[model samples]
Target: MSDMTAMELDEASGQAPRPLRERLSLGPFSDEWTAADWIVGSASVLLAIASAGFFGWSFVVSMKSPDYFQQAALANMPPKLDRIETGSIDVANAMPVPQIVRLSEPTPADYQIVMVFNNEALLATRNELMRVKVGSIVPGLGLVRTIDTEAGSPTVVAENATLHGAPATR
Candidate 1:
């Protein structure tokens, strides 16, 4: 075995010898990532989530209450009832209908009315008023409330704590 130190080997190879402490030095170039890097990365992630949440929430809220869709349905209604002369009803006059019901057959005094705005409704029969309730008609909207007996007598449950397409604020 040859007796030689690392310094001797380095010197023999015409290389500058490095001290043990200097060889073990931890400089910026040797670091994988700094505290500043972590802080900036975390901030970037937070900002992305915040921006997405802000826009996503806005879209969800708008979809929940689509006034334009409800308004369009009501606008197509006839100006008069059964050929009877009736003046033009304002948009406000037309009640928004989130749901509609059709009865099996038409009977005397058989009419449907809104019950609790989303749970049940009063269906007038010959003997008594029938309470008809159904599952959640609108997904986000809760249980049935309004009953449009003109069509199927199925009760409509909606969310928003009001009749589907109730009344416009303006």
Candidate 2:
């Protein structure tokens, strides 16, 4: 019996040093992911998207609802003339008089409005405190004033105030 050469065997099998069927295949359906597997994967992705959308909608609704969110009391409530006091009067008119205002609560004053709507006057007495709420509007709107006196002397005067929100009448 004659010993066969490696070259002769390879030629007869039409293969060199590497095996013909030993390549690493990465194509679809090549022992990798099948059509059924891909379909299931897509369905899972859709379910995840749907779940996220539902959760997002619920979160938004909860945030908007006062009952769910628990509304906070206004910081500038129990409205004090000092809290929203006038700084410097730039413009004043007899008809719907306008004045510049600023909040002086918690230090560092901020300019806002404490308007005198419809010729309504705001008379403040010494030591007296006023509280303004949601339903505090004058004939024109966004007008409010309060006052009280502890000692013997107090004063009530109108300096034409301007406010950010709706005004309350006298």
Candidate 3:
């Protein structure tokens, strides 16, 4: 019975150590390459050739200017000149004069309600902005209260503005 190490087995299999450059080269296949290696190499070479051909054709087409066939057809035509009599009415209809219309800006609109407290002072809003979902928030001068517009004027009762009169004395 004989015992063989890893290096001895490698040498016995007739497989030699390759250089780093050869191993890193375009050799994805092994030494004894199967049918798949040849097919892959051929396909890769064809793909590279097709890519280079497409780029070369594109560059050549872009470098040269196009000459249409219409230029050659027009060259065979003869040149002629004609004259018109004095005050000849050649047009069928005359064009009307154009007028420029100037547009003006529209004026802004505002709605508000004034509240007076105890006949001494009053609260009048200068600028009031109201939206659909978001209501308006205005500070009072002599009274502090919240105004809700759910129903008609009945919703805005006098009880809502109960904070009238002057400040409380201590």
By lDDT, the better pick of 1 and 2 is 1
lDDT leader: 1
TM-score (C-alpha, index-matched) for candidate 1: 0.22
lDDT of each: 0.55, 0.44, 0.43
For model 1, the local distance difference test gives: 0.55
The Cα error of candidate 3 at residue 63, in Å, is 0.8
Candidate with top TM-score is 2
**After superposing candidate 3, which stretches have Cα over 4 Å from the reference?**
1-31, 66-170
lDDT value for model 3: 0.43
**Each candidate structure's count of clashing pairs:** 19, 18, 0
TM-score of 2: 0.23
Better of 2 and 3 by lDDT: 2
Ordered list by lDDT, greatest first: 1, 2, 3
Which tens-of-lDDT digit does each residue in 4-78 have in candidate 1?
877788799899998885566577553566689879989999999999999898688679876865677789986
Q: Which ten residues in a row have the lowest lDDT in candidate 2?
A: 104-113
Candidate 3 lDDT by residue in tens digits, 89-148: 446564565863325321121223333223222232334332211132323222223443
Q: What tens digits encode model 2's per-residue C-alpha lDDT throughout 32-115? A: 777898799899999999999999987997878845534334643565555226453435532464653434222112222333
